[model samples]
Target: MTRMIFVNLPVTDLGASMAFYQALGFENNPTFTDETAACMVWSETISVMLLTHDKWRTFTSRPIPPATSSEVMLAISCESREAVDDMNEAAAANGGTADINPLQDLGFMYNRNLADPDGHVWEAMWMDMAAMPTDT
Candidate 1:
């Protein structure tokens, strides 16, 4: 058996959020989708569940922060720096805000952050293990 991760996020507009995620490379799984919720498959082991605010409230009583507030930053790895940049571009071209943080380059690693229309933060990163300096 393998472990899987399902991140549930509250979306004000289900359709727009679905589109936003798709632009960033996730595929919507119709099997778990409905008017109030959509299952976005990032990989076989990672799925992002976008739930409407109404549907989300059913699971928790915590108030959703205003769209301007940052809650959590979900970090995802990419194969190369180009891959990270591409996702950030796609996210901004669609509806998200790109460069929420300055681009970070640490010789062996690179990172960029973006915010979705609903204000969910996603960190796109790339790392080259072979290029990393070894401990003496």
Candidate 2:
């Protein structure tokens, strides 16, 4: 069986969060979504579950960190530099904040970071494997 990853996030507004993700090219999976939670699929093997605070608490008793806190930053690969820029722009156009981190350009790899309305950081990157520098 193929393995899959489901990233669950605690959101303040379910509808707004859904819209924010949708703008970034995620498709909502209604089968796993409802009023309290939404399943936003980025690809066949990757999906993000946006759950309201109440729904999130049911899964863990740990306190939900404030939006300013950063426990982890999720990343996704892009097809090209243009694609990375587009993703960052789309995120900013929506409810997300763009350029949360310094732009990275290392000849073969490029990356941009953005934060969702809930302040969950996401990095969109593009890499050219063939152009990567190799140590002699």
Candidate 3:
């Protein structure tokens, strides 16, 4: 069987969080969605679970960090640099913050950073395997 990953995130507003992820090209899976959480599908193998703060507390004792504290950076791989830029554009247009840092170009890889309205950091990146440099 293929492995799948589910990233659970805490959100203050379920509706807004859903919209924020949708803008970043995630499709909502209603089969696993409810008032407390929304299942956002990035692909067949990846899904993000947006859970309200209250709902989140049920599963963990750790306090939800405020928006100002960025503890994690969620990175997603894109097909090309254009796709990365497109995701950043869509994020900016959908009430999310875009371009937290300058564009990255390392010969074979490029990336951009974006933050959702609630301040979850997401890095969109593209890499050219053929152009990659290896010492080995």
Candidate 4:
């Protein structure tokens, strides 16, 4: 069986977080969603658990850091450069803020950063498989 990845993030508002992710084209998995949390499926292998701050604390002993003070960033890859732009645009329209950095256009790779309503940073990227290195 393939191992799937689940990224749990603490959000100030679950509904708002859900809306933000939905705007970026993710679908919610209602089977695992509830009032305290929502299961957002980005792909077959990638899923994000959006949990309320209080609810999130139940799984961790450490105090939840203020969004402005957090340093961690999540990076998600896309299949094309257009997808990267689309995600960034969606984020901006859905209460999230786009990164201040200039757009990266490296021919084979493109990336843009965005911060959700609670200030969680996410990097939307696209890598060209044609430019990937192959082992002989």
Best by TM-score: 2
lDDT of 4 by residue, 1-136 (tens): 8899998988998999999999998899999899999999999999999999888989997877776765777889988888899999999999998864577878778899898888888889999879976799
Write the residue-wise lDDT of candidate 1 on 69-101 in tens digits.
988999998888999999999999989999999
TM-score of candidate 4 against the unseen true structure = 0.91
Question: Candidate 1: lDDT over CA atoms?
Answer: 0.95
Q: Give the alpha carbon lDDT tens digit for every residue of 1-136 in model 2.
A: 7999999999999999999999988999999999999999999999999999999999999999999999999999989999999989999999999999999999899999999999999999999999999999
Q: How do all models score by TM-score?
A: 0.97, 0.98, 0.95, 0.91
State residue 121's C-alpha deviation in candidate 2, in Å.
0.3
| Runs of candidate 2 exceeding 4 Å displacement | none
Worst 10 residues of 4 by lDDT: 64-73
**Residue 43, model 1, lDDT:** 92
Per-residue error at 134 for model 1, in Å?
Answer: 2.1
Residue pair clashes in candidate 3: none
Q: Write the per-residue lDDT of candidate 3 for residues 1-136, one digit (tens) a residue.
A: 8999999999999999899889888999999999999999999999999999999999999999988779999899998899999999999998888998888899799999998888889999999999999899
Off by over 4 Å in 3: none
Which portions of model 4 miss their true places by more than 4 Å?
A: 132-136
Selected candidate, larger lDDT, 2 vs 3: 2
